[model samples]
Target: MVNEAQEYLADPVLGERVAAELRALLRDPNRLPVLVLATLWPVHWQRLTARRDPDAHAQARALLEEGTRIRVPDSFTAADAHVLAAEGSDPRLRRARECAVNGEITQYLAGVPVLLQRYEDATADARALLDAAIDARRLGWGVDLPTEFLADAASGYLTRAEWDEYGEQWPAPALADTDEHRGGFPGPLTRVRPRRRLRQTAPVDRPACRLADAVEQHGRRSRADTFPAETFWTASLAHADAPTLITLAESARIRGLYRTQMQLLATGALSNADAAAELVNPLTIPALGALGEVSRWAASIVPLTDPGPLARFLRTLHSANQKEAIEVVLARGPGRRAELSNRFGVADLVRRLYDWNHYGRFPESVRSAASAELAALLTRHPDGPTDTGDPKSLARFVNMLEAPAAACATATALRPRSQPDPDPSDAEADEAPETAMVLASRLKRLAEAGNDRALIDLLAEKPARRVAVSDPSGVAHLLRELTRIADTYDVDEVRQLSKRESVTLIADRRPLERVDLTDPTGVALLLGWLNRYHGHWTSWPDRFLHRLEHRRDPLYLSLRDQPYRNAEHLVWQWERAMLGRFATRAAEVALTDARGVADLLNTLSPRTFNYCPQPVAQAALARLLERNPAHHVPLVGASIDGSAAEVLIRALRDAGDPEAASHLQQRAFAAGAYPYLRRSEYRDYGLLPDGTWSPVWTWADMVPSY
Candidate 1:
């Protein structure tokens, strides 16, 4: 049988030699010791097949069935049977059953409970595997499968009691439940309900009300609340049959609430005179009227574009019984009828408007309107600049005109009435320069009085001295004037003034050259003025440079030369020092004279070289080499013993002198030379007693060749 089993195991056809030997071993009681080894044979073969083959299910199934069906002794207990049954419970162990039934386990398990238990276990295992797969997927792996297995497991696990408890606590479908509706315990399937559709509704529309209707309604509500009050009287007069809204507005001015009435009228909602009067009456209260109600009334009349009504209304206010009403009409008329330059007595009214306090901060619309009228008057009548006779008004007029018109008006204003055409035969003709000076003096006085127009006026005369002379030392005063005009007047005015003044001052160059550079205060002031008013210098470079060059007093020289002085001065000195050094060097070489070389050398003190040591040495050496190359040899040797040797050697090397290289190496090896030079390339040249060059080994030469 052993031979037969060996043959059978060797046979490629049946391939049951190992199985036959195992059976023979089981049949012999003497070979029962082999059963221990035989018992592990199927396990060993299964493990081997699992390791070697991609699919081991068939092999594992064959091994399991062969081991199970092979008869065992009756000495085995129920525990052993149970252990075997447990082994069969494994899906891997059931591979034989699955293969025998072609993956259908239905015919293998006759007991329903056993089948059900196995199915439950398999379902649970499937769920566990799915859970692991989901976990892997969440960690960015690529596993995907239907959720049916999870649904089956969840349904199978939900007992009646469990379902009741789950329903009581959660009462909602678990996210894991994905099955179709089933008749088991209430799962997600039975609880889900269908959705219902919703109905639609329509939108409503309405008509819009006119602004006039809205204002009338507001006025009616106000009147009802204040019945038996003066507002009722005002409202009644507002609705009276006046020819225009301006008439009603004039009538409302006599009543108490003209301010409120005017506000309503200005809303552009009043369709008739009566409504305007009602609006204007509330604004006439003394407290309300004085609160600048007329300004608002005037603005309200603007959109009406019928200046005739506004002009007539203002005339009525001017003729009103109250003095305050007259004052308001006169003072606020120009701003109100700003577009009507030809209105009766409007210029006088505009002049009166200037008298009102705080004109600068007037409503922008009012100021804009007033500016237009004033600009027109100034344009048409050059002589009638302003009716007010106030210098500020004239200034305001000049400020409003175009440049040419302003210039013409200023010239006309500044010329003395008699001086329009001066008599050449007059005895005072000789005093013309004095007269011009006096005119300049008067113009400056006007400027001081805050009359930029007068200043600009006198400037147009081209006074003998366009620049007003206050104090020669008062540069601060001059700066203040420039800054004042720069800040307050237009740029062209400032520029014209500056140009005329610059020309006037050009004759007396003393002011330009008289800077006290040594006086710290004067220096600081001058520098600040220079920097602040640098724009003024765009036309005066030669004048500025002249002052800088000619002012060389001890104070000026010291300040100019100080290293720790102002940054501008310091920068200027650095440039000057560099130029002076270069110039001295150039003279020393170009003159081909020993005196020039001596002069250049005399300037080379330790202090001079220390401050600008490199450039100073370079310049000196360059001069020496160009003048006389031999003259530099002793100097280079002397420098080699001093602190400037390296600088001197670099300068010579840059001049392409090979002797400089030989001298540098010799000096590097000299006694008490720079210790660091022992490691430098310059150490390779040694000085010979006969004054000849010789090569010497350096530490670099000792390094091994790569």
Candidate 2:
């Protein structure tokens, strides 16, 4: 049909007549199967419509409208491009496929080269408009540019002479060109419709556009060229939200545009504290190889504004081990180091620099300078290192400095010259392993230096003496020193001095009163030590058991959570210590109170009962039953189960409780022994396949009937 109507399509009147018949055929269901397709240029379509006749216009609209309009996409997707490339045997398809990039023809991929070509050839006004659009996109804010903003930005991009030539009528065409509608897709700039749904703050639909993603990528890739000097971006983006500024700031930093990055970050910092803190971002610091312009820009913002941002920025540089950057920044404000130290603290300053220097990053000169600075800081303090509240850290800082005067001053302040010599017999002092380690180290240094007074002062502290007990190496050193003193001095005078140093008394209390059960120190010295190191000190168990029986110590009842194993071990040790003496401390303590009986019985293992003397075992069992008669059956059953039935029966008989013993035996025999005798420990007592008691364990027959 297109072959027949070829000549008529060229003629306006004939084309209209032929288009009318095709439009009717399109509506007909029977003929619709016969597909009809056509293409027309925008210019050709415009020429075919009549300008003067209403009827001609109506006929023209009908012919085109009733036809199915199949529009060709302006660009090919990745898949379409690949298919085109694979089938590039056709020259036209091959030429079109050349335009594809990254397997697809993106708006930017197609448009940027054309825009660049246009930019090179275009007159001043067009270039101005394009420049404004590029800068806005390069700002790295989100890609939503209002047409009005583009116009304003473009006006700002124009010079005085250019603006004079085209003031209100800046003769640049609309950003979305009409040629785009005709399938000539020029890019790096494209138009978009406004999104105006509910909760959408986007403005009314008009000419809204954005630079293609390629534009920003291009800007970042090409950093050698000069960025625009116009302040229009600042004024236009002044009210931009924090997130947008942060994004732009990050982009600026990546592109080595430090001034731009700081400007964006500074603006964002006004409303966001985190953004304020972010001014310390390592990339944003001018001292770390940023351009001179950036250095100047930073100087303008920091030290001149709030010192908090500058201090944080300095700390970050120091933390990253960037020594040169710290020096450069500190050099900016001569008093910056001292000012920051005063504001935060010398302790914090020492802590920050200590971690860096501890790893040995700085040179000797740099370390010496840091030390001197710290020493000077110490001098300014009225009380030296003591004022810092962390003498160990301050002392360590000065020691690392290796400055003799500063180290001495810190030591002197730590231990005053006028400090009263501590009471040599004070045993009530608490012990801390950490503090002891530090003091012990200091004492060794002082003793090596032959600073007798300083060493004495250090030893006077209670924690200092703890080193003698807790650390073997420390006690060895103390013993050697004492041996040297004993050999060098008169023996009697040395003995008197040693007697004064001995911690035999507590305050004014004598040695006997010191370990009294009611005294907290004495209680801890016995029980706490026994719990942790029970077997190491055998004497304390006997002393502790003696106190348990004789002493009126109410605090013993509060001893909860003490390790039962430790109690068992303590009981065993107590028995060993008591064998030489006349009294059975365990039995005596069990007879004291109901709790004491339970405590004593609970700690009495079968091993202890088997090994313990008969009188002691009888005393414990009788006391347990005397306190609570109901304990008799379980006690007898426990003895049988533990394979110590002989011990329980003998103890019962010897304790003058034969009737109680006989009743217990009858209960065990009535129960038939199988249940209680199943324990593996009872295998040695006696065994039979029928689970009956052996003769050795069948004490019911041996029990003399009362």
Candidate 3:
């Protein structure tokens, strides 16, 4: 029996092997009458069958189609619920019956939430092992985890405390025992086939076991479960063998973990053929640093029609002053361009080379080479149609390159055929726009009636095609109603109205001009909505920043009083704008006012800084340490609250001031405070200022030691 057949088939090597094994079984005349049952998620099955490489998976795809396929109902029937009700004597069964609306009972029947909670209670190393396995499987590394790989990777998950508890027999018996007896009860690991071997693996031999598919499925649905992002995981990956490292690198690339993938490829396990394959894969867009490294591995690989990575690699070389090397690469004859001659691929190569030719970051010599190369490439592949969405942008970029006439003609050919206008009836139905006044009026009436149910229903509906009302009065009225409702209600459903399109229309109208600058609450609400909708912390719209800077009084007021969500959201956005617009304001705020210091320190809190970049906070520290070590350092230290104290302690320890680091360590020991790498970090022993370590804070630390 094969469970999660789709998962097994995702691995290229494993899929071919499965195909071969099945063919052997079919041909055996002496084979016993047998049935093979396999389960597949429709989504994964669709993905596998739709793969572009038909020749590579021809046998596997054919075998899958030849079988008598059966799809189990994803949702439950009424009879199923009645059966659940009959078993209602079991509380879990009763709950499942109650919650099985629209046939989403699979979640309840499988007990996804309960399983996740139980998994959360497991030992850190156990959870780490399970997470790694799930990620590997999800990335097509195969469901059957090798025993040696798990054992080798387990040490990366251990903390200082777990290391001390388990000592040198670190991952062996500890891993097997933890998996078998989590919470002192029999766990999933105890149920693997040949359970006796699980208990009998000696201290010296490699441990062997596989997790149940049910547990892995539960882990997949969990929002919190992920492989450790710490450097330790990368260090562990470096130990992987050539085949494993190559598969793992491919997985990392698909997941957009480019840095991790780069580190994996740098292990020298990737052969020239594998490196060439990686470069040719459209999905494998290497980072600039990775492009340079991968270029070395791909030195002998044939150049294709696509020059994106190669062009980027050449730019890196040029930046590093490798002028002669750039010339050598540019002079290489294009080989095997036939396979990469697709219209989209050639167009992309043209665009990339064109970008390099016009970009100011490249040296003039390199830009000229890029332009010349692009002119030659276009001349060779001038027949394909180019369909650029933005003709003007394409024309501008092409016009700047060396071969303006040929480049412009290529871009013009790429322009898509003009689309016919939509049917009037369908167009009206699809894009029925509503005025902002009407949306705001409807929202205000819903709130005033205090019908939270109706309000939630309205917000849950698909938002209108557009908000016709962009006037300042209409936008303000809409925001005022949203803020008032938000202040009154504490539920998530009501707050979700903030995400709807009508709210976005207000920002589109530029309502900042008319908002009352005196009301900090209104300004805070406006800023929060704008920042949330803007999507990223680093990129605040210039207009939004200008408005805040124009009304500096309110910005300063919000900073002084800690206006919103314990200053978590509003103040965080305010500080981001401050950093963006006025570069030195962070240090000025930290050095001067006590309240500003608290706000600045608050930004360093783990919760806040998780979304925020490190340099923004580090800028303040760098300035504080440089200008006035004695006067301002004490003020900044005095303002450290418990919430933000962890970040400050870590900052001081890493701040390169021996005296400050020593003094901070002593104080942390006295206060039972320790700086950890992550918020989830806990260690038994913390290093001290005097080149020694002591036990970490715990219940035992509260009582006298024996």
Best by lDDT: 3
Which stretches in model 3 have alpha-carbon errors above 4 Å? 17-37, 50-77, 83-117, 166-169, 181-186, 190-206, 223-227, 231-244, 266-272, 279-706
- lDDT for 524 in candidate 2 is 21
Q: Higher-lDDT candidate among 1 and 3? A: 3
- Please report, in order, the local distance difference test score of every candidate based on alpha carbons: 0.35, 0.43, 0.47
Residue-wise C-alpha lDDT for candidate 3, range 608-701, written one tens digit per residue: 4433345754564466456542233322222123323344445544555556545544333322233222323243233322223433433223
Per-residue lDDT tens digits for candidate 1, residues 1-706, read 1321222232211343344334444444564444322332221233323432112133233333444334334233446544655766777335434342333232233222222232234333232322322221211111122133223333333446655655443312443332122233221111123233353443221111111111222222222111122322233233322222333333223222233234334432233322332333323333332323443343243322233334334333333323343333334433433444333234434443343222534455544544554445444454446453455766465345334322322331111122234432242323423432344334345556667665665556554343333222244335445445534565477456745544344223333334332222232233234334434433444443344456533333564555554444443443344333433433233322222233333333223333333565556545555554223322211212433334444444555565854464344333113322322444223223222333553323321220
Q: For every model shown, what is its TM-score relative to the native structure?
A: 0.15, 0.27, 0.36
Error of 1 at 215 (Å): 36
Ordered list by lDDT, greatest first: 3, 2, 1
Q: Which stretches of candidate 1 lie over 4 Å from their true place?
A: 1-300, 303-343, 356-373, 380-706
Candidate 2, residues 299-345: lDDT per residue as tens digits? 33344123333444446545445566555544443232344323323
Identify the runs in model 2 with alpha carbons over 4 angstroms from their true place: 1-92, 97-116, 170-183, 186-188, 200-208, 213-224, 250-261, 280-706
User: Candidate 1's error at 41, in angstroms?
Assistant: 99
TM-score comparison, 1 vs 2, better candidate: 2
